[model samples]
Target: MKDDSTEISARRRYFRYAVFSLTALLVMSLGMAIVPRQPPAPAETPFSERARAAALADALALRAAGQELAGAAAGDGGPGTDTALDRTVTLLTIQARALVLPGDTPTASAGTGPGHRTAQASSAGVPASPGNSATPGPASLSELATDLAASGATRLTDALEADGGMARLLAGAGAAQLLAAGEIAALAGVPAAELPGWQEPAGPSAQPSPARGCTSAGPSGGADGERVDPGTGAGLGAALTATLDAEHQAVYGYQAALTRLDPTAATQASSLLAEHLDLADEAETYAALQCTAIPPTPPGYVLDPAFLGAPAAGLARLESATLTAFGDVVALSAAPARGWAVSALVAAARRTANWGVDPGPVPGLTLDESQLPALPDRPENAALTASPAAT
Candidate 1:
């Protein structure tokens, strides 16, 4: 009887142990089943990378439109259309090269001939406008003009989001696109009213006051205008000061040019002169706001003797020269300032065009065409070559 009792007690102990083990395992399994697993987070793209991709995408689309325009021009588009198309193509190609980052290879749709490829909407969330859809053949000149204008508008929007250097680049490219579009539209018989107008971005409520201890000297007469000291630092202040000085010089140049220009030309010069004076005042206000010391404007500026012989040409040269300063302002400033700078850039470029000089591919940023990245090795890009002016 004693041996039987011991065996029963040991069996009961073993049964309890097995039940505890099973319960523990079941609880662990339930816990695991009840909990959910989280997915790994995606890495965020950098602004620079995103900007470059967007710019390149826009450039490619512009180039495709340019190619279509080129074909149309070749086939009786209109007089001067060939020249306009050449410039348009050149601008698109240079902008594409500028947007290419180191180690990046731009790819286009394969098997499409020049003017045959459809423009892809920018991956930067820009939606395609009407008539931008892929077609069986080349797009009409009007359609191409619309695409260029749309792309230009997209670039301007992207500029607002880009860093300083990139903002300047995009602004210039955007201006180029608009200019090219206008030219092509004229050739295509599209009404000027039909082109989309670029709306300036909203500016700050009020210009900031100048810092303490900052002051300005009145205008002084000198053969060469007094150079404003671009403050100790390189920034918006410096850019504004430089632009102010450029405007002063421009005011002087326009005045001198007006003396030699024909009545018709003088009227335009006089109007532009007033605009330059206004710009000078605007720049001065901006500089003071930044606490930059304003130097006295020189009464006279050194002019090229050639300017006397060809005042109109000289004015174009003068206008072209001011672009860099305006571009600097665009790069260094925020809203209102940048908006002003962009308007200045576009106006200057248009003025240059009026004087019969083609503002090269990128207006503000001076680039060595030889150093720019070559177009990707693709069959469709064969006809897209940089123009002489681009160089």
Candidate 2:
């Protein structure tokens, strides 16, 4: 009986030991699954291979987002980076940090007296102190042009004088203006270049104020004379042609409206249609005079088939769309080429507005806030020379 008791105790002890081992094994597995070891923090990586890969991925994502914001996709530089240009811009950004001001107004030095003078109310206008003719501004574009020519100024300086030295001149005055306007663009606190970006202001500086340079002379009068260059005629003529093309397309679209909708519904639409046709004819006449071959209808220009009802209404819709489609072409065209296009667009827009169609105003046909083209520097640009005038 004592031996039997000893054997039972031994078996019991063995069983307890087995049970404990199993329990311990189970607990270890559970702990492992519930809380696995954490990966090392990424920042701890010191230029490791995996870290570099991660950094590159983040950079790519940022670049893609940036490209989208600029209205240009990642592949827009046409599949290759202009490395030299990129480097140049980077350098320029460094330099422009100084010596340049963004949108800085001229320092006002208490003009006149106690009361603030409106822009024109300066004391200088109160009869120049004695013999000085109010610092003698070049009274006319001609006088300014003469001054520029006499200085034998560089192309850039000539443009400044031509346009009244920022105190005057508007854009697209002439080649000199075009070049000069473009020259110092880089000097400004921005990515400057030879011509305006298709994307900023038309020039490096402010818009060239308008002037009637040499217009008083009849193509051959004299000191107050315009230079007559066939080139000028050609440019203007080209612009006229482009205007006509746009008008024709627009008119055709309006015609389509007449058939698709009720005549009564189109009465006002038809009137707008008539106006476009008249403007088109006028453009054609201008083209006839200059003899420049106008380009074909703007690339991808199409009739709006979707707007079959109420041509006038359809025009209202398509006007903005069409102007945008052609804007790039106008932006990229060379100076001489662009002059007429801009003028044509401006005139056509105005005429269309007068017809009560309201072609989105000048903004519809010009640079706007959303997308700015690079501004061009003033260089000698096309001017109305007398020789180019019709006899």
Candidate 3:
């Protein structure tokens, strides 16, 4: 009987140990089931990458635009003679280049009041003023362009608008004033509507003139004075007004694209459409200031049927064409306006690329030799690099 009791006790102890082990195992299993699995490591943000590329591209473009403006200013034998505009251009150029070039410093002042400025040239030969060092990258380039554009717009606009300032600038009748006016306004982010007044009244015509320099003759006059050149004073303004008309047409194109784009693409298409509207409005503002009868937008644009079938491709083609148009005007424009046109070109190029189009080596300008097979033989091609007449 004692042995039986012992056996019962031993069996009971074994059962309790087995139950405890089973309970512990079950609890562990339940805990694991309730715990959440970790999500995959977050992917790199698409915006960040795009921002970097855009910044770099803008910096490069701004630098190029600046150089062109400075050169034009210098050619006028006014503010550019002292390299005031050139110095400013150089400073901005260095800052832009530094953003893309590794081991280069971005610390540079935009220069102090007017042309009397001091700065050292970067290794790339662009002037750079001393300032806080910048982290050389896309973000830095974008930030620089944004900050400079904002500050420039405010100060320059105020200077031009205040107490006969515009009148005084225009009265100077210097090439610096004519060419730099649009560029300065562009840099300041001034709207086209706010463009400064012209001291003289003039108009533009599409025909080419024989004169090497600008002629004050009527739009159809045969004299060189009738030709459209920066020296003529009237052509640049006319070209700008015409550009505004082109921008107006661009808005229509975007609107058409929005109708055919996919839901996913429509979101981007809408944003692009809005941008075109703003550009159109700005263009009109400038055109109105010229006192020219701004060309009204046509009731409808003839969009390609292929674009209606494939909205993306159509939009891309439209962007490319606009970029080319802007480039055509750039060749004819003087300082400030020329720079502004370049910015438009860059923006169009970016949009074109977004639509899966290759913008080519030069986004806006067709400087490619292979593309211009007959360009070399044309006597007019020599003037292609020269300042263009208002078309």
Best by lDDT: 1
lDDT of the structure predicted as candidate 1: 0.71
For model 2, how does the per-residue alpha-carbon lDDT over 62-84 read when each residue is reduced to its tens digit?
12222222233223433223332
- Candidate 3 lDDT over residue span 1-391, tens digit each: 9999999999999999999999999999999899978889988644322222223332333343444445544556455332544543544343233224343222222311112212222222222211122222121212233333322222222222222212111111111222333445444465534532322112232222323233344223323332153333545446666567667667777887777778989999899988888767655544433334556568988877887888888888777777655554454543334444544555676677679875543444344343332211111101001000000
> What tens digits encode model 1's per-residue C-alpha lDDT throughout 18-116?
999999999999998899877789887666456566567657656776676587558575558777787788788888898776666544544333333
lDDT of the candidates, in the order given? 0.71, 0.34, 0.44
As for model 2, its CA RMSD to the true structure in angstroms is 27.6
Model 3 residue 172 CA deviation (Å) reads 31
Residue 330 lDDT, candidate 2, scale 0-100: 44
Clash pairs, candidate 1, are: none
lDDT for position 196 in model 2 = 25
TM-score of each: 0.77, 0.31, 0.39
For candidate 3, the 10 contiguous residues with the lowest summed lDDT are 382-391
Q: Candidate 1: lDDT of 164?
A: 75
Best by TM-score: 1
Comparison by TM-score, 1 against 3, better one: 1
Cα RMSD of all models vs. native, in order, equals 8.1, 27.6, 25.8
